[model samples]
Every structure is written in C-alpha cells, then in structure tokens.
Target: MFALMQSTRTQSLHLTVDAATGLKAVIAIHSDRVGPALGGCRYLAYPDDESAMIDAIRLAQGMSYKAALAGLPLGGGKAVIIRNPHVENRAALFEAFGRFIESLEGRYITAIDSGTSTVDMDCIALSTQHVTSTTAAGDPSPHTAMGVFAGIRATSMARLGSDNLEGLRVAVQGLGNVGYALAEQLHAAGAELLVSDYDSGRVQLAMEQFGAHPVASEALISTPCDIFAPCGLGSILNCQSVNQLRCAAVAGSANNQLTNLQAADQLEARGILYAPDYIINSGGLIYVALKHRGEDLGTITAHLARIPLRLTEVFAHAQAEKRSPARVAESLAERLVYQKGV
Candidate 1:
C-alpha cells in the first residue's frame, strides 16, 4: 500500500490464522543489511488496516536504526497483531503467530514491545525457540529506564548546560513499566515529577510512590517543566504538540516520537532541544543484543554508559553543522551502515 511505502523502506509480510474468527498480523522487516531483523511484537487496536500497516513498517525501520546506533549485530523488524489482546481468543492467536514466525527460518526475530509483555513473549516462545525476551535473564524496563535517564542527563548537559537534576520539573507522559521506572530514576536524581497516564491505576500508583502530581494526558504537553519525557507511544511530538511544549529538552523511550521527519525541524525551530528518539532510546535494544550474544553484564552496563558519550557527539554535530538533531543522528547511522557494507 502507498501508506506503508511512505512510512518505511522495509518488506512487508502478512500472516493470518483461521482458528480465530479473523486474525491478522503484519511483520515489517526494515533492513537486514547488518543482520537478520530483530525487534518487538506490539499489539494494539489500530484505527484501520492501513494505519496498522503503516505503523508496523515505520516501527520496523526505527528498530533497524535503534539496533545499528547501539552497535547491535541484528537489524530491524516489527510485528503487530491487529486486534485487541483483551478480546476473545487472544492466546490462541498469539500461538498462531508463533508458528508464522517459525516459518520465517530465522530471517526475523520477535521480542516484547509496548502492547506485548515478557510473559506474552514467553507464550510465543512456546511454538518457536527463535524468540528473545528481556525477562529471560531479568526485566529490561529498568535497564531501559536507566538508559533514558542517562540520555536525559546528557541532553540536559548539552542543551540547557546543567547536570544537576535537583528540583527540575519533569513531565512523564506515560506510566507503563518503562515510564514508571523513568519516573523513579528522575525522582532518585532529585527531579520534581509531574506525571500523567490514561490508566488511572498507574497514575495513582505513581502519585503514591513518588509524590508526583497527576495531570490529564492531553494537558501534559503544556505543563511547566524543564523536561518532557514521552514514554507512552510514538508520534506524540507532532505539529500540534510542538507549539505547546514549555520544556527546555525533549527526551524519552518512545521510538519515532516525531510523527514525521519535519516535526524534528519544528522542534529545533521552537528552541526546544530534541533528542532523536532512536538515538536516545536504543538502550533496550543494546541490552537485548548483549544478552543475545551471551555477553557479560558488565559489558552491557559499560556499553549503556557510552550512550551519553554518543549523544554528546550527536548534539555537537547538530550544533556545529547547524542542522536538525535528527538529521545529524541519521547521518551517523548511515555512516555506520555504509562502513559495515565496506
């Protein structure tokens, strides 16, 4: 479809199962230039088939860069189940997906993502051994949070020229595992937290745990904060939200935070330091890659620590070249990909 083409440069494959009334799956293998594709399986209720397809393809492409930027051996791929997981016949449908993945012959790898959890990945592991999970060793959410924390610190140092987070107001727009952990890290660093989530339970928990002030999800964009961390979903930073942001820096774990490439430029024009989503959020991919290679934990920690250094380079390149941060980050990734080819 044209929409899918516009969203990503990956090959799209569809899988269906008859056991359920109607089950559909889309897998976007963005690139295998570095290696076989590796990414997460996210389940969501898409607006339509076309939207689902576009999201899958774009997410897959982002995964490729996320892996490459983190120096992972794997390429990028993403899978999306096009139905609500809470509906009827969820487990059977996921198992069916496992078989579909098995048929790929190791060309694509599946892990956990937004809608999918480590437990769901475990379910998929039932039918195929190709599956990789963050929880097989331990929870990856905290590790991801730690990486974002480091990235936020690095971005703050580069943009606002500050390292101490004490009393810095940060608006965390998601309360999922990663967001909650992020909130904890910001709190531990003495940052003042203003949090929001569609899930009342998550918001309540955050308020009780960290003394966070709760705000409506949509209103979070205009909140007064030194930093705005979007850990919820992609495309939250768009034309509309850019003008509303009061934060000095934007950094979070969500991939493809910009709805489109132009949104990155818009952020730069607005005087808000925008950290490329893929560059800042590659920590989860880094952790998974290290685990996949059977590497040591110390190595993983050390690699993650290098995120700040890498981001510092990106920030410097953006400033020296007077180019959008996203463009500079993409150039770095393309350079790596080219070097690999040579």
Candidate 2:
C-alpha cells in the first residue's frame, strides 16, 4: 500500500488483514505536527488496494488542511476498510478494525464518513475510546451543511453583493446525507434549488419536500444558478469542469473539490468565487474533533460559528488581492498547521 503513495511524504500507512472476517483495511496518517491525528473511517469497495491507499492518503491530507483551517488542535489521518459490509462478517470485522485503531495508541483517531456510520463507530468504540461523532453529537452531516451554508452566504456576499439566499438559484449536486441537509437549508433560506443525485429516491424526496427542481447528474455543472454545490466526491472540479460551471460561486461539503491549484485559477479567471472545499467542509471534522475533546453542545455550536467568519475573511482577502480564495485559505491553513503544530 505504501508503494502506491511512492513519492509522497506520508507519515504512516498501516494495513491490517483478518482472513476470518475478510477484512482488508488501510490507515493513513498525513501529519501530527499540529496535534494528534483525527479523521473518519470509510468502508467502501475499491477497484484495488492501491486505489484504497491513494484514497486514504488524499483524505488524510485533506483532514490536516481541514483541521488547521477550523482551528482544531488535530492533525490529519484516515482509515479505509475495503469490504462489502453486506456480504462480510461485519460485526467481527469492525471489531478487528477497532483493535487496529486501538493499537495506534491514540496517534490516530476516527469517527465516521462515506460508507461508515455511527453504529460502526459503536463497534469500534468497543475496542477503543478514540471514536466520536456518536452518542450526544450524533451525525455530523447537519453541522457540515450548516458550515457550507455559511460559506455559500459568504460567497454570495463577496461575489453577488448580497448574503441573503432568498430567491437565489443554487444547484446542489449529490443527494447524500449531507447534500440533503444542505438542500433543505437552501430551501429554508428561500433559494430556488436545482438538485441532482445518483439515487433517484433522494431526488424525488428533495423535489417533494424542498420544491427543488431536478437536473440530470451529468448536466449539473452547466446548470445556470447562483452557486454550484458539489456535495459528493472530490476532484470533480477540474480544468475542464471549472469553465463549464455556470454559477457565480462554488461552495459545498465535498472535500478536495479542486483537481489542483490550477482549478482554482480557472474559476478565478472565469470570475467565479470558490469557497475552498477544506475550509467549507471542515464542519464535520470540527464537530467530531470537538466531541473528542469532550466539549459540550453549546461549545461546539460556538466553535462552528467561526466557520462563516473564517470564510468571510478569506473572501475579503481574495477580493482585496484579486486572487483565488482557495489559495488564500490554503495559506491560512498552512500557517495554522505550522503554528499550532509548534
């Protein structure tokens, strides 16, 4: 697995296998200079182990950037279990996976993401106390949507000259847990929603509940709207799709949305404002990280309130310098990483 990350300077990449449970897991730690590593457990079928290793590395790196920007004393790490939970001995597998985390001795902590859930966290908790986003905190999806809402409003303020989402046409791609919550919030704010998802059931629900118009998945980026919210996978916004985006801004819960720094440049040159993915999507990580610190609900709420403020700062700086907000956010996060890690 480490061979997959060949030239990249990864801190650690640990894989565990249990033949009895058919468990093949990979844990990647990107950095711990700022604090202990905290991320999520992802359970999904990969084309191969190399793909899973690459996914873990990218997610862990994103978590580090996300943690720094969110002002959390945490580094970046991620664990990926490559298995079809539907067919495997799930309970025994999750328990064994939890022991892997336990063996890390708190150097790496995890919550939930993608195919993993709170019940999986409970199973992991049986072996280690390093799991979070469970119990009182519940799912972090809503908080993540809230933070993205803050970012979208910030983008509107900077680019559209208004922060009010009322009547704003926003196209949200992907209708997963976080995407549904975001679509709901956008509707509540009176924004006309254009929603798309691979799951047709979710699309029908969004249309019925939020009055969202449906767009085909492939046509999402070209839809005319005030904002384009990519709430699904990462690396979708590349040089090609960047120009295809018809919105005035981009903000969503998807991590690593940009294909590279050049994607940011493409958006900027096209006069589109982009709220950095890591900065906007850090809300989930923030919730879990705060929960790990045993913070109360009120404290977590207060801390989350900073998400918008940070975005506003990034927006203002971007406008002042006429630079991509992505670059500005990256510099800010790196400063935090270096400072806090010190």
Candidate 3:
C-alpha cells in the first residue's frame, strides 16, 4: 500500500472501519496544490480492499486534473465506502462515515458520486460541514451533461468545421442521469440519438421523452455515429474497445475514460478526437465547488459556460502541437497548476 501511494504521489489515504455498521471506507487525497481538496464520496462494493485503494488513488488523481482544468480554487480528493448496494442500515453507516469526514477538518469536502446521491449528501452533512450537494444546486448531473453538450459542439466544430449538432447522429453508451440528460439536450439541439442502458426503464424513458432510438447496451460503443458519448463507468476505452470504436469523436461525463495514456494515443492514431473526460465533465465539479464556497449561482453558471471555450483552446493547442487532446489537456493543466505553484 505504501509503495502504491508513493508511486501515485498520493498525499493521504485514510481508512475507516465501523464494525457495527459494517462500513469499510477509504479516502484518498491526491493534492491540495491549489486549495482544499474537494471531490465526491463513492459507495461501491469492490471485490477487495486492494481494488478499493486503487480506485481511490485513480479517482483522486483524476479529480486533481479535473479541478485544475476547470480553473477552480481547489485540488482533488475522493472517498469510497465499500458495502453492499442493498445495505440495510444506510443512515447509520453514512452518519458514521460523516463523522470520519469531520475528522479531516476542512482538508477534504465531498459530494454525491456514483452509487451515491443528493440524499446521501444530506446524510453525510449530518456529521460534517464539509459536504456539498445539499443546497439548492441539488444534483450536478444536469450541469455535467450541459458541459458535455458544449464540449461535443466544440469538438465537432474543430473536426467537422461547424459547431451545429443538428441532424448529427450520437450514440450514447449509458442512460444514467448524466447520459439521459445529455441525450435530452442533444435532442433539443436537433441531434439524433442512439441510446442504451442495462435498465430497460431508462432506455424506454429516453426513447419516449427524447425520441432516442434504443440500442443494446453492449453494442452501443461499436455503433457507427458522429459521436460516441460514454456517460457511465471508467476504463471503457481500453485496447479491446479502442479497436471496436467507430465514431468521429468521444466526449462524455465518465471519469478516467482511457485505460491508460496509451489509449489516448490509439484514439489519436485512429484520427478520432477525444475531449479529455476530466475537462469536459468538470461542470458538475465546478457547480459543487462553487456551492461549497458559497459563491453565487450566477458565478457558477458563468464558470460552467467557459468549459467549451477552454476545450476549444485545448483543441487548438493539440492541433498546433500535433499531440493527442488528452496529452495537451494534461500539459495545460500542469502549466496552470505550476504557475500557481506546483
């Protein structure tokens, strides 16, 4: 564990054990180079503790990059609670987890993440004043979707020479909150959607509400389309999927989209544009971070509007340097962070 943390340059890794509630949680704080570390609390049933620790490290590092690219006065951190999805006593467990957060003081602030919700944020707020998503901002999914929508336009504009999404075909590989909302936003922009999800109910809702065409979940990524939006889990762009992908570009809300840096190279070699997931999907983080700081909604909205502009800059830099957008984004973020004192 020590070697793993050292190799990743992780700042801190915390473990919480609550025997009574069967809560086994890990909090990974990657950086506070910019400001207090802020991220989301994820509740997942990992196969083992090693997997959980690795997840925390990867997620925390991703948050650091996401925060840097978004221009927020914050760094990155993440907490994971390992438990069954259908755990019987959620309140007690979360409350205990909240106390653990309190122990960190203001070093880390958490919000709703995968397998968690605004209601869970409320429960977490019970023990620490360090939780967000409990205010009027509510769910950050819509904001994330909005940013992705803007990112797709910018990517399309650069690659295809027009930002208009009208009549464009989009294959959405997930119909979760962010994915469904993104599909709706695209439909409103006059784009055709090929939507899929493991849950038939979500797929039906997307089709009924947005006129999306349903595709089988497993096959959506390989479907031919103008854009492939992966709004679900991470590591989807591995060696196998990269060979199968058939799209002009990929821009979505999922974190850690690349299996590793090599996946970015593979996509670039295929002439596929990739809007770095950390940059494009940072709207939700910006919303929550501003809310945590008690910044006005107008400021948050304005900040969210800059996502596409920054992405455009990233695209421009990538084109000029003849590098992958992911690499360009990381370089841009590193420069910013270092300029502010790495």
TM-scores vs. true structure, each candidate:
0.94, 0.95, 0.97
Determine the backbone clash count of candidate 1.
0
lDDT of 3 by residue, 1-342 (tens): 888788766899999898887889999998876688888888888889999989999899888888888878887999999976666789888888999999988888988888888888888888988888874558988888988999999999988889999999999988888998899999999999998889999999988899899999888989999999999989999878988999999988898899887899899999999999999999999988987777897998999999999999999998899889999998887777657753
lDDT of 2 at 207: 94
Relative to the true structure, how large is the alpha-carbon lDDT of every model?
A: 0.83, 0.87, 0.88
Number of the predicted model whose lDDT against the real structure is largest: 3
Q: What total of clashing residue pairs does each candidate reach?
A: 0, 0, 0
lDDT of 1 at 145: 87
Superposed by TM-score, candidate 1 places the C-alpha of residue 292 at a distance from the truth, in angstroms, of 2.1
lDDT of 2 by residue, 65-161 (tens): 8888887878899999997636556778888898999999888998889888888888888888888876555899888998888888887888898
Show where candidate 3 strays beyond 4 Å: 135-137
Model 1 regions lying over 4 Å from their true place: 2-7, 338-342
Report the candidate with higher lDDT, 2 versus 3: 3
Stronger candidate by lDDT (1 vs 3): 3
